[model samples]
Target: MASDYYITADNVFEYSRGNSLFDGLNEDQIKTLFSISREITLGKGSYLMHEGDPAREIFLIIEGELEISRYNAKHNQNHVIATLKAGDTVGEVALLDRGSRSASACAVSFCRLRSVSFDDLQDIADKDKSIYSIFYHMSRNIGERLRHSNDVALQAMEKQLDEFKTRVTLGNFFVYIVIMLSLFTFSLDGLKYIMTAGKNSSYITLPLTLAFFVFFIFFIKTSNFPLSTFGLTLANWKKAVREGIVFTIPFAAVIVAVKWVLISSVPHYMGRPLIEGLTAMNADPKTWWMFLVIYILVIAPLQELLSRGGLQGPLEEFLSSKYKVPLAILVSNLLFSTLHLFMSLEIGLLVFIPGVYFGWLYSRTHNLLGVWIAHALVGTVGLSIVGF
Candidate 1:
């Protein structure tokens, strides 16, 4: 719903004084314009107007943000072309051309605006010649928008040309592999503890993992790849988590089935329950709940960042093969599995199977949320609950 208010002459000037749309207007002209203008407040997510609708009024934004977008009927999507902020004027194109709106506008946040109808503007023009200045300013604003659009298009083309010129080569892939292997050396300290029985690896592994994570961040920043390339952003988090859950359910069921087969067919096989495994690793079973929480929140996300985001993302970019995605996933998991060899050959092989799935999921979404969720759940269920 929208609220209407009567804006005083003083309030009107305060709002319109520095606005480009009202430039060169005198005190008397501004006052006359506001006299016929309506002050309206729109809540967030409210549509100001739809594309193809008759545009009879031009609005000056005093506060808040609005998205100007075009709807594609074929795609069933709205592509936001621009975000209008305070001091921006909207719907001026309709006033100039006497046509419908070219784009739809929806308030991004609570908005306060003053709108003047075309009919009222014509009446003002008949009474006073000075009103033509407002139209002139509106035309200038349209020209500025056109120039900005051209500049943005030119920048996009330049970026594509640059990418084509410096396309990643096999040498680039080898360089990246070398860097990752160099970083993997730091984890050997934790591996020694895992290999030695009765020596809890958590104290050693935790700090080592944190150090590796810090170095990973440094490498990513220096390499000039945006964090999004590694799926560290909050974009589409809900969708990412939803896809992760969808992937995880069937994967978890498969793990359970594998556990069932092992228990039923294997002679004298003793399944390692999560509690017993924690105890065997010298972790306090009393704090088992806390460990599960940390595994889900911290441990899972950290490993995903290293394996999928850090390794696989760049591998995909560097590989020119038609099957680059699968190759990247395979190569990344090879390194991922190799790191666990210090623990045990069996453990290393087991880790590769899930690492492949995680890498594939990361490739599809390119967001951490989904892969992180899947990794956390699979790890918890396989090692802790289902007992691999």
Candidate 2:
């Protein structure tokens, strides 16, 4: 039979003695702390708090579960973000801000909650200056919970990444290589393939870009990997940007030194003007910037998506399991650099060093945001140094 007796200070102190709220407190301290609180029972499916409701109280779950949800405007529905159980606390932020609730919460099961109102807290604070210590204790409890939540989120990400790594197949890597080689061979230069095979380039690269995009979708299907396998997520984008900057620094130094030596000597190896014919179709000098924008916004993303996200990703997965990370990084660099072989050895080397840097970075992080940022930085720097 379920025991549904009314709780006393003695029981509250007993039950929560080792709980986070009472953590580091003695029995007397726990009893004194919990003595101010009262208990209430909420029925299953009843709202404990509604989004936009005025915040006046916080609750510590004594028994059962509460489902916390937020309304998503995009979906036109409520998405449950979390569930709170015994020993969990909610609405503490409200007591601090006196702001409205940001989410809806309802009991998932018949719940017993230790209710501590803002008014009650104020009374305790007014009586004794030592009540400031309670606020400190509350902040510590919330801070610890946030830290624990962050740890759990990171672990989940690793688990998801592992699942994606497992889904990668050797076939995906081979197909991308063969398809890309065929396209490169047929075009003689990748530029013509991007052109409309007509008098003007007129952003014809857009449709060719779309075709390359189709190849990525095909890669996902063939590899049996989810689309989530690629790209930096909101959860990890900050880390991606930091890692991208740190990894690219040393590589950028070498790139600058190498290009500085060859740029004046080799006409073919240097100059943003090299791509002007393909990008702008030899349009007016003023129109060069417009075409450059297209190249950066459209072409760079697609190219990285293809080589880094599509090719390097699965190759890393397949090879890393056997030969491990270094071999996978080397092959990805070699393949990326090989694509530039149509130009010249000097040009190829210039591209190769950055390719190696990018390949290694993505191998370690699997974050496409970082890869794209690195690509943009390196490409922009190259264009600037080589002139229009």
Candidate 3:
């Protein structure tokens, strides 16, 4: 659909000015190049080209990112070999030899692309000899990629060896699971009940949260893992938040719709409706402010740190399964839901749905801030506002 998208030569040139492929072209030649190329639009996760496909053209990135990956038959997985961004070129090797593609190109986000075929280059070369300069650049790009590929292959081998050596044993996994569940109960129920004498659950989260925060820092220091291992850093906060919001909105809408159906269809549906709770809290302004502040500041981040950082982070590193990351997320969320069973079965099940979302979001973003924001929004809206 990029053919329908309006784009001028000037726009393409400006966007790709930093790219080495267009290094020395004059204004007219650049215009000719743009005229010969076809624009393309790709939705996130859509493939532009697949490995072993006959290559008819080379592509240029105008905007957004592309993941260059190859399927590994041994692992039965598509291993990402490279990431291409604006001003980068793909499929140059195809132009050189007219061979099948070595790797697949998939969009990481919504993308704007421009592609040119070997025939198009020949047309320009006939008119002007300078077109061959692009070919020269393409050769250099191929050589660079080949070198990079060798390095990546070496790294992959090293990673496989490391995983083989460090893979967690079944007994070790059970120990970890037990330890995590014990810690969750101790923090949420045992310590809270003791400190508050079972009278005040509102102000208890802050102290427990602070204690766990200190414990995590100490544990990280002793364990010799980077803060990033737990998604504690603020790196990629903007993109993380953006992606989290995009992922959460549609799911949130579905949840709201389900809640509406339940309230309308079921008799005496879910005692203490959100509206009545809000009205009662509104009658006491202090209570409303306390609820918001506690959930947002203390509860949301605490839960993320425990479920994602404490449990899922370690599981991802130690698990040796082909689908380790997804397995880690699922296993961690099972424990996440289990910890909430003390509240009620319905609450336990409901938390698992959101727990999985939070886990997946953390996996993609690798930042606690974004996941925390998403958790805060969803919990406040779903539990406090919608009374789900």
Candidate 4:
């Protein structure tokens, strides 16, 4: 009764012809193929194989269409190489050779596929010489198609790469012009301030003047940007808090050790007294509590939310995998350091290093815990010794 089910032989054969390899197979052969194969269904836009993944099995599309794409390094794009309709067999060559997949395959529509593992096919080929011939031919055909696709992709990428280079050159020219204008404005303002105000006025103006310089520097640095977005949102606040605590602990420990070393090594001077006072405050139980509260409740959650939470997800989608982690950490570290600019340069730099470390941890874990523990530990230890 199941054999006499609504799924007919004519339907199977018609589907088989959609694939080039099965083009020559008769209804009996299609039925035999179906007997040996397992059916799989995929939703539209689902991946069958990812680029660089080991090809383990060949897929025969029984219904719908599949899209094949290869990563093109020159254009930094995933180039669509082919559209495969029903009955097409893909990954035969890579499966047979046990090689990395040169192209990725995704379902263009809801797809029904029959998959035959390399081992199963090999067993069949070993038993029947004719089957081996068919298998060999199918593998060769898939290889040829893949080669042709690569060639076309390369040619298209070359053109795109040239266009991209030209655009970058033009963009940089405009950026340089902007930087020049900013420098001119700053120079004029500095001259006017100096002429109108006394030496003490220069000290009073120093912070504001430096702020402008830093703003311009940041603008310039980020002008020719790759992907940099923050994805953390208010919904992720709970997760960020968890991450922040994990990050602060170890980070605080390291900070404590570093501060202790500095206190032991640095000679007593005006700056030393201040540093000593800060270190002493850390030893106080009240100071420890305050430091813990500030780091865990205030700084960790806020910083992670800003750097890793919201728009960062979309920005990361556009970036090359290799550049993503570094960029995230760098941007986060810079923001952290900028927030501490009002503090002493030495203290700011000290905090900046730990901030960078924390950022790296956040990027690597995609969780806030590691960085939070590091931060809290370092802060608690450092402040305790300094008599905070």
User: CA lDDT, every prediction?
Assistant: 0.79, 0.69, 0.77, 0.59
TM-score, cand. 3: 0.51
Q: Model 1: per-residue lDDT, tens digit, 84-191? A: 998899999999999999999999999988888999999999889878988899899899988977886688689877576345433444565576667668657655
Model 3 stretches with alpha carbons more than 4 Å out: 1-180, 183-215, 270-283
Per-residue lDDT of 107-169 in model 3, one digit per residue for the tens?
998888888887888888888988788999999988998899999989989987755544433
Could you tell me the lDDT of residue 130 within candidate 3? 85
| Model 1, residue 199: C-alpha shift (Å) | 3.4
Identify the leading candidate in terms of TM-score: 1
**Model 1 root-mean-square deviation:** 13.6
Compute the lDDT of residue 269 as modeled in candidate 4.
Answer: 27
If scored against the real structure, what TM-score would every candidate get?
0.53, 0.46, 0.51, 0.39
Q: Given candidate 4, what's the lDDT at residue 139? A: 68
Estimate the overall C-alpha local distance difference test score of candidate 4.
Answer: 0.59
Best lDDT among the predictions, by candidate number:
1
In the range 136-244, model 4's lDDT, one tens digit per residue, is: 6686686787698778879988978866854664465346435644654556556456545543222322343344444434433544432232332243546555666
